[model samples]
Target: MDDVSWKTAVESRLDFLQRENLDLKAALKNILRENENIRSEFEAMKNILRKHVQDTDEKCNRNMKKSANKEIHTSVEDEFGIDPERDGQRVARIVPPSTSTISSIAFYSYLSKNSGPITAHHTLVYDVSHINRGNGYNKNDGIFIAPVSGVYVFHFSVCIGGSAYASFEILVNGEVIGAVNEESHTGMGYREGSNLVVTFANSGDHVFIRTQRSTIGYVFSNDMCKTSFSGWFLTN
Candidate 1:
């Protein structure tokens, strides 16, 4: 071979190799750019997911706190009989019966004024002539609200005067528990009627005497103090 031809062939081979190397370098640069873009996108997505999780946790915590506060407020109200809306200081309380033979009582001696047509299953108001041991009785509305769950004995007595008619019912809440009816037909002497009830009651239950029937009647407590209502806790 001639020297000039050999030199031309070697220079051509060198040019081809150099072009291939440049091409590889350009491809590597493009791959590196693509990797950088992917890293930026991955970081953004991770931040978004982390923010979502944080927000969800915070919302759940707030809801749980609200439920706990509401439960605590309700418990306080039930235990103390505290109506937050009312203005006056709470003087009245529900005294739980003690563990004893005669632990609780709701006995009132007599009514000074004759109060009736105490009809239609109405709660009676009585004068606080006497109360023994403990008091859960409201003299304003003659209802005994129980402070503890127990069995109790309740009694009511009345002497219907002349020209008078009377009937009594012992009630635990709205249910009729006991009854007694008497009428003075002669309009001359007093007629006596009484009702006794042994009942089971839960805390916050109401027990009271109501007049089912009354006609031109007077429940007298004058000299003998015949009209009376009494209750005592029998079992815990």
Candidate 2:
């Protein structure tokens, strides 16, 4: 072959090889870009799966806590048979001693170990006196109500004239439970204190003290009129 023809053939072959190399590089770049996109998609799927698992675990934990609380409440009710969620009943009250003349007295309600703790959610105070005497004996002066179901302790006291006999009856829901009666002393008159305990099934039960005579006098004090309860429910 002639040198010029051979040289021309060699140049044509070199040009063809360069074009093929350019095409191959472009194809490889596209493959790399596609691989990067696939990897990003896989990472996104992994993140979503992790979030789903965490949410599912949290939901299960919440359900378990709720079930446990329900079981505990049910067991307590079954054993005690007393449901504070329902009706309320009065459990205790302080009754002032009976007096013949008009006098001021006080009553106190206290918390006991058998009773539950006193909370804001439960508690109520009724008329201090069921029937207040304008200048004489008052019947409406010393009454208290239970705020919740529990055991309660009550204390009450009264003072009468030196020469007169002082007598007081403690009543729970209008029923007589205790009494304090004594002859008056020359200096102190008649001062008597009484303590009574009662268990209320629930809440809203009434407790009061009534004077049997008019000459008997009574006085009520803040220290004498207090109510406290417990947090634990009693069971058989």
Query: How do the residues 1-236 of candidate 2 rate in per-residue lDDT, one tens digit apiece?
Result: 99999999999999999999999999999999999999999999999999999999999999999899778755555555534445633222233222322222223233211212223212222233333222222223434544444454444444343454534555656666655554555576334445444444335555555444443333322343322211122321
Please report the TM-score between candidate 2 and the true structure: 0.35
Clashing pairs in 1: none
What overall lDDT goes with each candidate model? 0.74, 0.47
Worst 10 residues of 1 by lDDT: 88-97
Encode model 1's per-residue lDDT on 100-156: one tens digit a residue. Answer: 534645565456666655656566676665774566777777778887777888889
The parts of candidate 2 lying over 4 Å away from their true place are 1-142, 145-153, 158-167, 184-202, 211-236
In angstroms, how far off is 77's CA in candidate 2? 13
User: What's the C-alpha lDDT at position 43 in model 1?
Assistant: 99
Residue runs of model 1 more than 4 Å from their true location after superposition: 1-106
TM-score of each: 0.53, 0.35
- Worst lDDT 10-window in candidate 2: 112-121
